[model samples]
Target: MPQSNINRRTVLAGGAAVAGVSVMTAGITSGAAAAPATGLLSGGRTPGAVIPPSDPRYEVLITGINKRFVAHPEHIKMIRSAHDAEDAVRRAFRQGKRVSVRSGGHCVADFTCNPEVEVILDFSEMNAVEYDYRRRAFVVEAGARLYNVYEALYKGWGVTLPGGICHSVGIGGHVAGGGYGLLSRAHGLVVDHLLAVEVVVVDARGRVRTVIATRHEDDPNRDLWWAHTGGGGGNFGLITRYWFRSPGATGSDPGKQLVNPPKRVIAHSFDVPWSKLTEAKFTRIMKNVGSWHEHNSGPESPYRHLSSLFNVNSRAHGRLSLYTQIDADIPDARRLLDDYLAAVMAGVGIKPVATTKPSGELAAMPGFLEPRELPWLAAARMVGAPDPVGANPEARVGLKSAYYKKNFTDHQVATFWKYLSDPTLTGVDSTLVVLSFGGRINSVAEEATSSAQRSSVIKVIFQNIWAFEKDDDRFMRWIRAFYEDTYQHTKGVPAIDDVTDGCYINYPDMDLADPQYNTSGVPWYTLCYKDNYPRLQRVKRRWDPSDFFRHSMSVRPRN
Candidate 1:
């Protein structure tokens, strides 16, 4: 992952599809969604600020990171606090206008910016990160972004949340979506440390009030907390803030409440030229990467200190890359990284040597490309893999994700090789990214949190990034065909099986709901929630009986 400059355009791009209402509480890593605010009180009971379509900020606010989706809402309600959100939600309910809640606008689906959405409750104004002495936990507002949250937590208390890797992703949908990133393997999902969430909800009687949900079993709102653990965003209500304190954290020290990532980390990257990579060699390389994770990604594995992303770029790119980071605190960290690289390059016969030999910092670190140590905070700022989605701000991208419980089968490897190596599919950027999963993430029981795929060791993303609207169809066709071919045996969807656990809600995809695409009869909800769908539906029925907050793939209340 390279540290790329995050500009305003990238900052405003939030993933659109998340839980329709909101959720609070729970440790969820991996999937990106929103974070909750304080349940105890609204900051100053701030008033909702209205921005009409006529306003200059209207177009900017209405447009999300993905240009694919846009809304012509009558107005936008910018919430500075939970009370503001309550007012906005209540107004929308009374006015009979459909509303969408937006945090970071980089969503994969059109959850926010869409034609059907009449109004958007923009939580971007509610961005705030602080340790609440009264709550005895860190409070990350729904509007908070990943980079700011990391800088605030690390700078203020030297603590961190194991959440999204993208710098500009919002906390609103990200926290509830059970998002994870580089640090997740070492700590756990960000939701794992969640203590409580504050959300604004419209009751059965059309009355909107702010509710505080906690993980306390006896708490009346415990179900709300459970739903948000990994349930995605906007399902239950509009989450205002999230309180995070480690599972067994005690005493008054907020600094001790969250996990402290390594002060520094060793970053590594390697490139395999397409020209030299034969089909046989490619299969071996991909298999080794998966098998390595299958072997080393366990709750107790010392390799948990490491995380990597293998970017299987399209043939047009000429080279494939793997980005990695390992906590430098562990003994034999360098050797461990070396062995990991050895495994990836084992049978491939691609020996990487420094062009001009070594000197200075390069002398001690022996490996391909640049492998060096840097402050952990700096590492969090780097962007990779999905970076293509945000690279141009104007880039249109399509993505599909799955959690792999086991290594890549020979057939799966062959499919990946076919799409990425095919000469005919050109003119667009596509990447089959395999992100390392497992480690402490698998330690949690599947039922412990809303994030159900706990046993998975690999998270796969099939992505295509293109610049022109005219090229959307072609790029989409390529990505879809590639994905379907990879899962041909599973009826074009990653159903619950020995190798594939299912899809991730954070990387929401509507194709799974379309019969034409998902011939597999496995309902879209089952793919994301697995057996947890039933419980989530019950929570939706209880908390959002009116179904006021809804979106594609939102939890449908069980009869």
Candidate 2:
């Protein structure tokens, strides 16, 4: 990993207090049912069930996966069962209060963890995953962590569900948002195999009902299952449990899902120097690797044994780094790797320093989720095919990308480079990362699951991480300018525009919704959902018409 020149002392010099709060207890108190001016219950609750401010559990409930956004809600309701969730929603709705439901607290925008929230329907107490060998499936509680689920499946049935990279992320939001990870390239998305969901629905009359939606194609509520695939969380009703159909199964068989865990999974990292390479060289490498992946995707392809991610980070400090990952066994892996490297070096030229290691399945999982830890301050935009232009002598920059398709045209490649090399941008990190997107991912259709970017050949993430929070305006301006410049460069260019699908939801950025940033009027959902937005909106209307569950970019109910 490239080290940042910005010192730790410099980051804290601004004295911005990290926002956080304490977890309230589970019990309720008297007069807590009164609705605040915001229409949400700001306080007052049933006696004997309230967790007062004096309780010890108060502190733990407020922190989240990011620890970036934290504020105490008026009240915290710890739900032990699906019934508790249903009841909580009903109370909040009856009081005309805005409610936030929290699963793992991984929400970057503080949707469920926000201080403005009056009622928090927390599911942390419901972490449980049960395997039914006879049915060849697992019923997982919403609060279950990815790691816990993995542990449970492997221990009880020697099986696992394909899901996100982080073990700490809650299944509720993860699956509701169309979870994907290492197994994705092989097993498809987590939702692709979803069998059923147990949700707490609040009717217009303020009555609570527990409803179940299954994968049965003939089920009337099949659309509910589709919405969970990628519709995102807080839109549909609160899902307490998810049932997953075991992959590669013939009727009921627990052992079917447990492929002999790879005896040895090896990883290799290649870091190329930005100073030594020209813009043309960088573009060539991106195009070559991208094309290779697109051509070799599907059940076939000579390099099917390998899964790789390529990224470039460009900064205003004149730093550039390109990184790639190849997943394969150590023996023949080197040869397969060389082929990729050669393709990258075809037109442009740069020799990269490579590092290789063998890791167990558990240890290797984190590698796929690597980008999550990078200091992210701004929202991200997804780029399909990127072309690297010559280095901008005036600006320090970094760039990175993930290739889903095998290749892009030279014109597409050039257009990408032009955007990154633009001047006038400042206070941003010079970095870029290109991740590998396709292998088994492409085999699934856009509608097959809620994750709609399946047609994209590349998933480009543009990020800027700087040292000072005070530099927020300048940094944001720089990144937004870069994004617009990139979009402008590709406008009307068939090869670039036609193939340049929008952005990723996980890399959420509110700027995409701003008319100033998104001149195309393409709402963020269009970038993330495409045709699936309308369906998601329908689900949102059906489950949360009052929009009780919402955030900046959450699915909105259509009129």
Candidate 3:
């Protein structure tokens, strides 16, 4: 194993970060429900399709989007409702089998597909999106994909949740990890509108049952609800469904309850080729990005309605892409678009090879993938299209992520230029992606929900992907080295500080758990949960005393 890049001087900083985060939280005022209700309620059991090794679907079901890990569980159970999920768990428990749950099958890590897993409760079949009249919120099943959720909410109720741009991400892990996307700049995270969650957990007595936890102050399981707000997946329990009702919304009309995204958006996208850009220009562009977000990424910024994604591709790919979107309904929407481009491209003299926009179609940028045609860029077309990841299942990937509370330091810029332009790792398509984060997102306090990374101006992800299993190690080493050099002074990982506020849970990087890679005494949990770890631990012990729901990074309860 390779030794971590941390020096002796930086190790102590991690301990100090943990010691101080206890005061990093605040309380959110929620409406009162009838009262706290504990349940041993079991729904009618219906046996779903069971696939064993012999079944044809088993091979496909065991394979997730990432080709890195594949499950060899004894069998996979297809689930539909809360009853189905509970039944699968109870059966797995009774048989003393290692259990894992799959939603949308998009987990980049091996949480679900590992050697020890004896059974996988596949929830992709449980997808259901509908408006709950009684609760006055949209009830989305855990297995439901982002595109389906958007289609149902927008077409049926004229509303949408502020979530990731990837159309196939599952509601279960996404919402639980504080999902965000283009609209997050204006509406906040997906969890910001979370009203309640239906979770199937193992009781202290080893009995399986379902609990409905809500943000309602009087609800007994309110802590559970808080934990899921940003606690990460496979931690507390199996989240079967999430109920979304915008906070402080009191109206009866469902259409008026949730956020109303701009019906039309102005999408501008362009690319800068490495062939025409210099290292100095790239560094200047990177610094300007941090400055622009620092000045404009706020709740009251007139540019709040604008969101942008900087797909700074690894130099091996030959080009960097910029995609910006703003509510066309806003006044001076065009000017907002032009000013953003000017600010980011200020000193960089390189311009797009050609500016292209369709005659009658909506122009847009699809993040995490190449730009799509204008027709596919339309909101409806974007949602209906399959995610490029799901569209192809041959690539293996490794990820490292960071949250920036301030602009990029000159040192950080140099690190990026060095890694992205490294000629040694020839032909590797590793990318240092910068997403516009923190607008209305920062409006909430650090501890208001489980998602503690609210103050960051931008989110950065270091991603590398390859086509063959044989090349996994080379690609992983390259990306890891790239990230290590960027935070070389900070114990090999992005430690909590003024410039960097730790990592995002949604982008789980197991390297943080390895002492060899993360010499920072601050443990993976601290880097992710911060001060909120203790509260999440208490909830873990209360709801899952035996720690029945667990994985490599699952919340562990103190005995």
Candidate 4:
């Protein structure tokens, strides 16, 4: 999607009613809850931690990015440092409780906030992005959000990590799941620059210790670091911090060595009113998008710095929007952008309209708006808003995702249009967000990291955003049916086919692991990890032999 700055305030601004806890009927729990208490850990109070279900902040603490699942942990430790995280893990082990860690609280799946969790280690307060001279890398705490990392890295050293656009998405999960954003086309995935990681792991002997793993060969714990590279969170251990530096980057001159942020960026948008959109028009648009990306998304493409998000909203939403951005530093940037758009129109047999063309509520032609130029930081701050249209971040969300090796097939495109054009569906907030993927990101080998889907050209996110509890069933049913039908030819889920590469682990869907929902016969782990599943499982066995860290979709030990 178009890169936008996501910060804490905007992320929590709007959404559905406060979520309720999904308590597992038989999980371990503390006996009869009393008044709020502290000192849940061995040390006195552990600074400012709070044992939950009793503390006033319990509800807020467990409410995460999706708001669909609420955790009811017996204890919520407000961890301020790595020591705090280690201590919390030790406590969970001693108490025989299942532990879950929260950073930006953005897991789409119920992994972080389910009833199975007995202890929650909150890292929200530990957010810090700084240059570590000793390590020769930029150190980002797991709790730090993308916006924070961007701002800090840009202002301090003129470098940044190519991560997700959501500002409030914590680095912990984002990087662990192979973080990507608009810059991914130019810088590759975040894991490509990952140099080292600090994690709190539990051994088979039940001892909790902090381990620093790195990409360096001599490092005995190098495999541990490899697992963190797109292995997904809540698998082997609780990550405390990550260190980033471009591969082969040397010297202390951060500005001269690491990837620099675009000096300036040009942002542009076009609106295609739904009223003017027929099935043919929609098909043409999808075809144009697919064709354009297929041609331009190569490691050496001159348009690598340009990326756009095509948001196909349902008919009830009145309009579909396309947001595009390009590095203004490139020569004749305006002409490049114009030519790119013109080429897209050509692919669909249409003429470009004037930049200032006035658009009606449902214009037959896309109305292009004047492009705006902003400095790197200014653009990031403006673009970083969670929603492209700046919607409230508190909106409850359900998401399903897929990676495309090429473009949509004719059947898939028709299926999309059929469900999206359905007048009977009531969730107007739902949309299909197609993000431009590939470029330098694809240059990496599939086996280099756990994120094995290296050749995808587009990333598709199926989203349902709503605000009412009563509408939950309706929204869920709508999204589920839409997804099922879209992939009906593939056994109710996206398998590794010519058109699909399963789903993104970062956008984890429990349905992929459920036999009731996934009848494709291909295991969810294979869908997400492909050939990397075995290595990840081995890492899990080594770091968490007791299976101390786990979730519904966590990597399991080899049988």
lDDT string, candidate 3, 1-559, tens digits = 1111222112110100121111111111233222221221122224578999999889888878788988898999987667677778888878878888888777888888777888988887666566655467777778888777776778777888988877777788899888998899999999999988878888778888777787877666789899999998898888887878998888788888898888787766677778887789999899988999988989878788888777687767777777777888888877877898889889888766432321101122334132222321365444335355555668677888999989988888999998888777664357887989998999999899989988898999887777798888788888888888888889888889999989998888999999888987888888888888898899999988887778878899967
Regions of model 1 farther than 4 Å from truth: 1-48, 352-370, 384-388
* Candidate achieving the largest lDDT: 1
Give lDDT tens digits, candidate 2, residues 191-277.
877876767776565557666666666555677777888788887788877767744557545556443223233444455554666
Output the worst ten-in-a-row residue range by lDDT, candidate 1: 8-17
What tens digits encode model 4's per-residue C-alpha lDDT throughout 1-559? 1121222112111101111111111111123111121212112223446766877767777767666778877778877666667767887799899888888787877888888888888787767565554446676778887887888788777888888776777888999999998889888999999987878888888888777777877666888888988999988888877878899786768664467979999877776677777788789888888878888899878788988877688887766777778999988888888887776556454433332321111122233367878787776665566342213446577789988888788888998899888998766767898898899999999988888988888999898877767788888888888888888999888779787887899998888888887888999999999989999988888989988888989998764
**Candidate 2 deviant stretches above 4 angstroms:** 1-72, 258-261, 302-305, 315-334, 354-430, 466-468, 489-497
Record all residue pairs in model 3 with backbone atoms less than 3 Å apart, i.e. clashing: none
lDDT of 1 by residue, 1-559 (tens): 1121222112211111122333332222223223332232322444666999778888887777677778899999888666567667877899899989898787878888878889998877666676766456777778887888888788888899988777767888888988788888888888889988887887788878767777877676788888999999979999887878889888978789899889899987666777888899999999999999999999988899899877777777666777778999999999999899889989888755332321101111235366888889876665422344554667677889999988888889999989999898774357888888899989999888999989999999998777789988888898889889899999998879999999999898889899988999999999999999999999999889988899887888777
Q: Rate the local accuracy (lDDT) of all candidates.
A: 0.78, 0.56, 0.76, 0.75
RMSD of each: 7.0, 12.6, 10.6, 9.5
Q: If scored against the real structure, what TM-score would every candidate get?
A: 0.89, 0.74, 0.88, 0.87
Clashes of each: 41, 71, 0, 12
Q: Return whichever of 3 and 4 wins on lDDT.
A: 3
Better of 2 and 3 by lDDT: 3
The window of 10 residues in a row where model 3 has the poorest summed lDDT is: 8-17
